[model samples]
Target chain A: MGKNVLLVDDSKTMRIIIGRSLRQAGIDFDNIFEAADGIEALEVLEKETVDIVLSDINMPNMDGISFLREKSTRDAIKDIPVLMISTETGDDIIGEAKSLGAVGAIKKPFTPDKVNEVLGPLL
Target chain B: MEIQDKMIDATKEIFSTMIMMEINLEEITDVHGPLTDTITAMIGLAGKRKGVLAVHFPYPVALAITSSFLMMDVEEMNDDVHDAMGEIANMLGGNIKTILSENGRDIDLSMPSTIAGSEYSFQSDKDVEKVIISFSTEKGSFMVEMDLEK
Candidate 1:
């Protein structure tokens, strides 16, 4: 048993890859949960306690940005550290994610080792 | 005109450089039917150029490719590997978008979509000036389709 992590993304494929990366990285997390979009993620929070959130920035309905925006206002979800992962590497998006309280940001096409680098200290 | 060519080239480079694979279309007469073992990554090209850029690959090859790229062993193709296929497509589209500005084309991109099923044809609506570049790995068996519309 290790820390609990909430993985958010619209693609199941990506979740698997990221999950594999986490395991390969040896983050030692227990009860890995996943949400297709922010709306579902919010729902997961109601009953589950996640130590960290590894999320993608783009999604349908409630995207990563909107999720962060809304989550910032919620006292319960706000304190939980979020790591933004997506293909968009624009400075503006990074700035925005940082402002929204993302503990870290990693670009897409990322290796599992990169996941470790981002989550090592925090999680 | 060059922007389109450049985008095509970018895709070719990715498959060759990252996957250690190359694709060709000289004998691809029927680009239809089922590619059951195919791995695909699809991403949207928005803004001035709006459409989707997808990478089509054979299943094991995709798993093999991503596995090698990530340094992991994916015995069975799962949702995560499939999603990585899509993200790879997204990355190809995103990088090409960067070069569009120089050619006077402004574009916004959307997330990628990855699909792994059997027997499907990915045909583009527009055929006029429509571009489709193919790449094949030196030792791998598959093709990458860059179906982009301007």
Candidate 2:
């Protein structure tokens, strides 16, 4: 079966840009899902069969750290790898994310080449 | 390099990598006049360093940036423009935070917000050390201003 990816961000513009970057990087997916925040992301993960998640750290309703904490407790979605695409590149924050099961991260203001460099290995 | 130089580099990188537009540094100043027919997006920095990062864009430049961002033609100021501008400020704010704080735990960044008007003033009532860097794009020019508490 083909892999699917989910994008979680509050900004519609960012979601569109990420999707565009994925296409520009020649990373095609059978399905691409989206959510506005961690709560919506969790809901999508529960309902959809997603291979990976690309999320933003700062968001309304539920932020990325809280989302990781919440997702870790659920067995059904616990194993799904998440790669962060955010402006938050702080060691403390990224370290916390890695501790919570995030596979890796891509900083904001990144190029398609950067996206490919970071996300290619996981795929 | 000074904070001003870092800000300039960050702004250029954002424009070049994400917006697919090359921007040249116009000037660096501590103050600017009132804005007209422009949109401003800002993000707050709290915790160890209290300040705000703002980006001011004229209507044409903003529309062009938004258009380039989405790879579509944008002729009007809409939610997409606001969101795109806000995200730019967010990214800049994150970069500023990295510059200000080494570990990133000492500071916190507020969600990005925006204000647009035909005419208005952007100033700080509190004492601040301000640095405003202006840049020019093919469409027009814009400014990135940072106000840190003194």
On DockQ, the candidate that comes out on top is 2
Candidate 2's displacement at residue B35, Å, is 0.5
* TM-score of every candidate relative to the true structure: 0.71, 0.99
Report the lDDT of model 2 for residue B128. Answer: 100
Against the native complex, each candidate's DockQ, computed on alpha carbons, is 0.21, 0.91
For model 2, give the interface RMSD: 0.6
* Superposition error at B148 for model 2 (Å): 0.3
Candidate 1 per-residue lDDT, tens place, A1-123, comes to: 567989998877677667877887887787889999999988887669899998887788898888888889988778888898776666667678889988888776666678888889896
Interface RMSD of each: 5.0, 0.6
Worst 10 residues of 2 chain A by lDDT: A58-67
Evaluate chain B of model 1: give its TM-score: 0.73
Candidate 1 residue runs with Cα over 4 Å from true position: B1-41, B58-85, B98-106, B111-133, B138-140, B147-150
